[model samples]
Target: MTRIPDQPKRLRIVPISKLAAAPKWQLETLRALREPVFFWFTAGQGRITLGGSTRGVHPHNAIYIPPGTMYGFQAMTRTQGVALHMGDPTGLDLPETPLHLRLRDGSQHAEVAQIMDAIQRELEGAKDFAERAARHQIGLLAIWLERQRSSAGDDSPRGLSSTNANERLTARYSTLLERSFGSALNVGDYAQALGVTPTHLTRACRASCGRTALQLVQERRLYEARRLLSETDVPVQDIARNLGFSTPGYFSRAFSAHTGTAPSLYRKARGA
Candidate 1:
């Protein structure tokens, strides 16, 4: 028998509705990804918190998030969009920061839609060199994003600015949390590392994203626990230990409180 090699993971588009089908915590909780993502909304409205800043989004809004940035959103209405997951943008000329552009001009919207359509077709087809063709289309999309950012000039999203002290501090805290969420570090320990008192750190977090520092830390840990439970067959007790919970009972209680389901039950429900 001839051996077949596994196919490399290619970029793909996910409809916003399908993404919403996931558990609410998976979408609404503060978490970070290892790959960059771009969201293009065609209808409805929502408020998204990215890098400790919350902003409203509506139809024809394009939001770009770089890898390792914490973000979450609440869809106030029926949201409609597609998310492009760009895996390992090692050499792409993409933005290093987040962008939320409201493309008001109909022409601009059409241009983006066209590029996305091309990429989608290439991904769905089995034609020769489809991945390469899709990558070229991604390049075009990157250029479009650059042009939109330049044209927006001063009218760009305010959340992208790092001038605010609270936002900057919260951003740093988010980075540290992403790196060390698995450790047994509490909010006080993190505050000490950042050279701020726990009270001041919580205040800054609330001012920036409406969540206290402790809440952010717990949310990130729960997010990881949920991911591990749903995606792996690892033992529940082992998961608790790996996530820094002092005891399996405590971990189960925390998971149930946040998700309304115990960790073992959650994994069974996910068919893992």
Candidate 2:
């Protein structure tokens, strides 16, 4: 005769009691290949069995599992946190980062629970800006988890470094572009950081990324300009200056060239 252990009904909510009850209602669901499932545990601990190993992922711990990475999880005990089911995920669109978090002491439980509570509210109510709010919180949670893990003296799971010199140079350049695109906006400066000549940097970037270093700089700047245009109420000339363009005319011309529309017109068309 075959034996089947009693399991909690599918998608049933379990009440919070003590730590031992955490795994009482362990549930498993085979999500789609590209689903974004964000996990947070603020109450009890649990074992996350993934990739043929059972690892403990507890409170203040978070990870972003890439698509096609076979994994499953169960609670350590009956605990509460946000289990966000991200919608329509394209693998590259998500952050390629995993987070491990820890608390200073008992005091951090409240803070962690607060963050999860906010996410839970957004998930439950389904408000107009819930998705936006949840995304913002997720970014914040990622940052917070990294800091917590660093403080706890665990930094083992960062992404692999780029393979070649050109790839390394491009990665560093991309980081600098993200930080300074709004002000310094210079490919030469990024090259200086990499201890390489501008020509070499341009060649490396072109070979590895199929674009010149300057083109990457312009691309990032233009990207920021477009984001601000579509999301904020800033003036056009100010946006140009903010993006480090020398003049409004130059910015307008560059924007037109890249996007085939004036910044203002583009924003207007998008109903920003």
Candidate 3:
């Protein structure tokens, strides 16, 4: 019998180490997710770039990223934590903007850990009402986030402020890239749409994320390519068309160059 491709889960708790085990580009590349993510770090330290600003993240740090925000981080150390992917925020009391909290209170740390563990149990148990249980746990986690943000006051990560002109431009560019990556828009097109020259855009992106505008676009497209190849049974040709590649052959070459493996082989190795 053939296996059905697994759909992306809405509610889940993933270990930080497991997430780090994937190819670095998947997480370290500047990109956005469609769902809100709450990362609770229990050990290790590294720098995380969010909203075009980079900052140091240590143990007990909690980062909340709303959907459509551009963010990435370095798995420089033996990072140990749990990442909670909250499906839909329709009625949840989550913050509208990104938040990076350096949690110093022991009780606060324990509270987050417990909430994550509870969500994990509900998801893994496969018991009756597990979905409902998980949702409730997520609600509680949102409340915890609110209280922590309120008490922390000015929960901004340091380094570069999002208001910096270059950072702001980079943030806008990233947002547009995330929304239109599947289209055939090139870096020049993006720069024109943003009322800036291609060179300026590239410079801003480099300053903000150490990547040129073209590199950012290529990475974002390839990231989605890998996701489709590893997570779904979509044909390589379809994936190419969907991602705006002119032809399957061109897509294969690009994918091979980026991953050092053909799309088919990548999927087969993953047993997708």
The reply for model 3, stretches above 4 Å from the true place, is 1-7, 124-127, 151-163
Off by more than 4 A, model 1: 1-10
Q: Report the Cα lDDT for candidate 2.
A: 0.57
Clashing pairs in 2: 21-78, 22-77, 22-78, 45-76, 46-76
Quote the lDDT for 36 in model 1: 80
For TM-score, candidate 1 versus 2, the one ahead is 1
How far in Å is the alpha carbon of 207 misplaced in model 3? 0.8
Model 1, 159-269: lDDT tens per residue? 376437888899889989988887889999999999999999999999988999999989988988877777767788877777678999999999899888989889998
Winner on TM-score between 1 and 3 is: 1
What are the per-residue Cα lDDT tens digits for candidate 3 across 1-272?
A: 22323325387788988887777887688778778999988888888878766678898888899888888888655889989888876777777778788777788778888888898999999999997888888889888877766665332442123358888898889889988888899999999999999999999988977889999888888888888788888888888887789999999999999899999999999998
TM-score against truth, every candidate = 0.90, 0.47, 0.86
Best by TM-score: 1
Q: Per-residue error at 263 for model 1, in Å?
A: 1.6
Q: List the residue pairs that clash in candidate 3.
A: none
Q: Evaluate residue 1 in candidate 2 and report its C-alpha lDDT on the 0 to 100 scale.
A: 16
